[model samples]
Target: MKKVFQLILIIFSILNSAQQSEIFKLKNYRISVLNDSIQETSGLNFFSEKLYTFNDSGNPAELYEIDKKTGKILKILKVKAENKDWEALTNDGENFYIGDFGNNAGIRQDLKIFKIPFKNNQLQNDSLKIISFYYPEQQDFTPKNISTDFDLESMIYLNGKLHIFTKEWASKSTTHYTLDPDNFEKQAAQKIETFKTGFMISDAYYFEKKLFVVGYTKKTEVFLMIFNESNSGIFFKNNPWKLYLGSALSIGQIEGIAVDETGIYISGEKFYSPIGNTKPYFYFIPKEKLKF
Candidate 1:
């Protein structure tokens, strides 16, 4: 009986070690600290050969164009809208979509996305479109507050529709939902699929037929997922390359991800954890360095 118990202990330790070994330490090159005005940077997007970002709740409703090399604020474009938890940014070549659906409490009924038109590399204020949507599966409006699966933060524009990924704090998974961009009325989001990602998906980006998601766990464990597209909206059909990219203790609270032809860009807000305090900063991972 003693020998059998020892053998079981050895097996358990080996499995734990294997899982720990999967955690990869990323060589994060800190470009610079974000501007003082845009401290709570929530989402990032590359458009018109420039990087654009915005602050989350409690900040002014403005879009900031950042210098890619220095992380400095080059331009600030004010949008005529409310910043009720702006979480994700994506552009459809001509129009930029701002997701105002960062429902950490899971009880918000006013989930919306703002569509602003841009022409000649400038933002036009006359054609502001508001898209209201709701999840068809959410039956309860009760506030779960960081413990609900209805909270969403990541989004991408694909095939003339907007794809949203939920930040499920309770279930540690993400649900994919599609919304038509042409529809302005309150619409029902079509649930497509769910991926069990064990991390709260904070931002999403689609590049070269691949979908990338960046997020972190409550314990500060950070992760990045890359999915090869099998269809337009079908992302979970193939298993994603789940890379455990160190911990938020060293990387801060990762909230945004953007991929360009060169490599991946990541940003994190100021985070306070039991391990240590982390300042808001931007990081770049070169293309050649992000090997599976």
Candidate 2:
């Protein structure tokens, strides 16, 4: 097909950060396990076309409209907010951003990001619209352990800008920030330049312009970055990240990724806890079998 898409983009330009495997024949995705061990699962979003999961903490703030390809939950939306460790999610068709900022002990001072609006696809209430902010530069543990703890799970809202991704505790590597949820608080985050990515970056999705980032350490990998449209507009800020590492073999904590031309959907949230109770796997990657 174009030489398997230029050899998976030349193995994502020699990008490898652990788990070890560079085969690339990709198109092997199937985790079809709907609702199991999902208590403190994490964030995932798509809103309405189905697939809307959330959790990491508390209350009746649930929503899972799944079935992008048979992970089947069908419908279950209702929120009030208490999803503390919510982590990351993205949407802009109207609402559904939800990312309470997972600050794994970097000492959070109140970092949040919740929108939740949507109407026809239902979900027009429950009082939600909090886009708090933090990280005014105060870091430590230069490379201590637990994977470079910057926290933020994953996010996306391109064009209007809202790209946040970082989960680098002991340094598995990932850092990209740029937010302005319409001036969340008079514009705060603006760094967007760090993806030496070798591993560790738990969730993120941005279809057409393609930017899928999943993660794992003992195995479970997925990375596809392609946001190069010359990055059009007002003194462009940071659309320079380019990395591709996917062909799946280490499928242990793939987290969650979503793209829809009827292809590309992954999830692996078995984070060790009383989650939906244990059994989450829904991988069906295909978009010309993605390369590298």
- Candidate 1 weakest ten by summed lDDT: 9-18
Stretches of model 1 off by over 4 angstroms after superposition? 1-21
lDDT of each: 0.87, 0.62
Q: Which pairs clash inside model 1?
A: none
TM-scores for all candidates: the values are 0.91, 0.33
lDDT (Cα, tens digit) per residue for candidate 2, span 1-292:
7756755553454355322443442234665655663534465677646676665655356767776767767777776777667767788888777777777666666777877787887776674677777665655534333544577788888788788878875666777777778555634667756655556677877766556666654333455444443353121234434433443333334566777776667676553321112345667766666542
Instruction: Please provide, for model 1 over 231-274, each residue's C-alpha lDDT reduced to its tens digit, 9 standing for 90 to 100.
Output: 87789999888887766666778899999888888888888754
lDDT of 2: 0.62
User: Candidate 1 at residue 179, lDDT?
Assistant: 96
